[model samples]
Target chain A: METKKKKPRYDFILILILAVAGLGILAFAFLTGGGGASVEVSVDGRIIAVYPLSDNREEVINTPEGKNRLEIKDGRVRVTDADCPDKLCVNQGWISMKGQSVICLPHKLTVKITGEEAPESKGADIVVK
Target chain B: MKDNKGKNNIRQKQYIRSVTSHGMLVAMAIVLSWLEAQIPAFFAVPGMKLGITNIVVVTALYKMSSPSAMGINILRIILVSFMFGGPSAMIYSLSGGMLSTLIMILLKKIRHFSITAVSIAGGVFHNIGQVAAAAVILNTDGIFWYLSVLWFTGMVTGTLIGILSSQLVKRLPDSLFSLRSGGTK
Candidate 1:
């Protein structure tokens, strides 16, 4: 009989709070991710290159760790190929909005989209900050 | 002397019983891990898993002692990693498994929280632990961006595993644990 003890009200409330909090954070992430103008590529936390989303090109980014082929087309950026083990970056498909990124953990690679400010013009400013 | 001999026999039986049960639980968890891996990368978010294996761990926590559950979990992680993953994957699993099991054990100790609540905490902390491991290993905070999505997924999956575990804990006979705890008596 003890095994069937009714669940305490606290459990329900706690679960509800956790669920609502999770959804709220997800919603905030989506809302804050806005339309951006350029693609920024970084390896080991250092920005290696920035390309305007307007351009269409395919280039292989060679990092000391590995290589990832970046493709920018139709105002979107994606990793078409990678030599890393997981290939999660390639699987991440595409990103065209601010704050959205395709990360490859093995290669320590991050491809993120940045808003408005031209990447090339403010690249040095970003480093200083 | 006779009583001591009987007690020793009971202890031996309990040891065998616990080992067999732990082996079964570990096997079930490994099967679940492999099954989860088979599910094609359904979510675009990398490193996200449906976490079905948690059902076994949650059930173990309620049916068995915390130390026993923790043992089963660690054994499963090591075996599953060897079978289907690499050293990096093993590190992530170890961190997540340890943290989540600790949280679940703590939550269960509170007495007020239900099985579902404990399971939810386990699920959420599992993702946090994994993300933290990845951030440290990769040396970048950008991975934190996935935390939000991972949280949402964790909550949803946690609810499911919770429901399943509660049902399992209800159905499994009490004799299973009594054999372990009541051995000396």
Candidate 2:
């Protein structure tokens, strides 16, 4: 028998790189997401309503397909119920961070947490470089 | 004339064999898609799926040609959409499937990337394509935030699929892919 050298079969380093990249992106997303001032509801891409996070309220969004119950409480918003088939939006639970959203694909409805204009920034032409 | 006839016979056999295998793989893909849908959404994040059908696609890519894998994926998405999904769902799946398959094919050409790495790329791109489609259709960028969560889940599911398909590629008899001894190249 002759001794032979074999090349490594798996690219484990690639997997590690991807894992770290994914985690880094997730951390960035979390760190940059928060301080939402209001919850906005939209149907068919049109803004239907905007509610302040300070107020706890329940509202129903009616789309061409069906109805979705949007609930905002304690600065977080969620879809409590929907007539859509998958009910994925309802399952999405609550989201409070800015840019977070609960989307009902079937109904074409979206409940999103948005960072409204800061009071100081309102009616001010703040220049940025 | 006799030699030409024999060659034609072998070619016909190979064609039949390839067709049958493609059909079987497509059926498997459709079944996997359906089975995945049956599972309740355990995660609280939207656009999250176990991507069980990806196992079939990855197996096809390694066992067969790129076109075969792409065809199986597209056919499965269309058929499943007809049965269980709506027009919007079809659009999302089509975009995701096409993008993922394209990426996997490109990755397969490179020597350093293993099957798992290719699969992870496929999974991640699939989510990206879907989210892009959603952002376009829904006319909002807020939902793009889901990409953060989806990328993580894609990597996890892609690893599982890559491992499973690698096993299948190793264990399955080559005769399953090439029935005739000396068929097509």
Candidate 3:
């Protein structure tokens, strides 16, 4: 005679809570819209360079793995070329909006657009006081 | 002496059955992962996936031991990565799969939440693990921005897999899982 409390069944409430939370965050992200005027280039999570979107320029980034060519033209940025196998970064096209970004997974490079000024910290008031 | 031998024989049979069943579950997980990869993603997010393969892991966890589920999940990641993606894919998948499985097993042990909640947590952790791996490989914290978006997607996909696995658990025969538990008739 096995005696163990029957495993609790699926909780719809939990699922609903998760769904609401996920959707809420997504909605917030969408509503924020892309409004940046500059693109920030990062490698391995650290900002390596920043370029104004109004400028037209090209940069070749070299790392231990390989090189990736980034081009900023007409207020948009993109990975024009890369030595990575899949070339998915080059295929990602241009990003010109505040939140738009292009990432090269193979090279661990990311180019993300940002507003002219950094957004205020989410908990700035609480932390500062 | 006769009773001991009989018991040993039963144990041997159970072991063989467990091996075969676990093998089958691993195969199922691999195929599911591969199939999901073939489908064009609805979203533009690079790593976002339907996570259909998780259904097998969840089902295995419910039906067998956590170790068995972990083994099956890991094997599926390796096999599917080899078949569909290359080495980079393998690294991401291994990191994400291991983290997700660990989270799911821990949640299962807690028993406070339902299977759906466990799966949801697994999904969230899986994305976090992958993002973390990508950040390490790329050496950039910029990738963290993807976390919120990925978490949202994870929740959606995890809920889907949870619902599916729940239905599957209900339909599957007890005999399918009885070998490991030693409930053979």
Top candidate (lDDT):
2
- For candidate 3, the clash count comes to 12
Docking class of 1: acceptable
Clash numbers, per candidate = 0, 0, 12
Taking all chains together, each candidate's TM-score versus the true structure is: 0.83, 0.89, 0.75
- What's the lDDT for all of these models? 0.81, 0.82, 0.77
- Per-residue CA lDDT of candidate 2, range B12-121, in tens? 88899899999999999999999999998777777788788988888888878899999999999999999999888999999998999999998887746778788888
- Candidate 1 lDDT tens digits, A1-129: 464567555887778888787777677767777787877887777887777788788878888879999998998999999998667788889888787788887777888888855445534322312
Q: Mind listing the fnat for each candidate? A: 0.42, 0.59, 0.27
Candidate 3 segments whose C-alpha is farther than 4 A from its true place: A1-37, A40-50, A56-100, A114-129, B180-185
- Candidate order (DockQ): 1, 2, 3
In model 1, which regions exceed 4 Å deviation?
A27-38, A43-48, A62-67, A82-87, A114-129, B181-185
Return the clash pairs for model 1, or none.
Answer: none
Return the interface RMSD of the candidates, in order shown, one decimal each: 3.1, 3.8, 4.3
Candidate 1's DockQ: 0.40
Ranking by TM-score: 2, 1, 3
Misplaced by over 4 Å in model 2 are A1-10, A117-129, B179-185
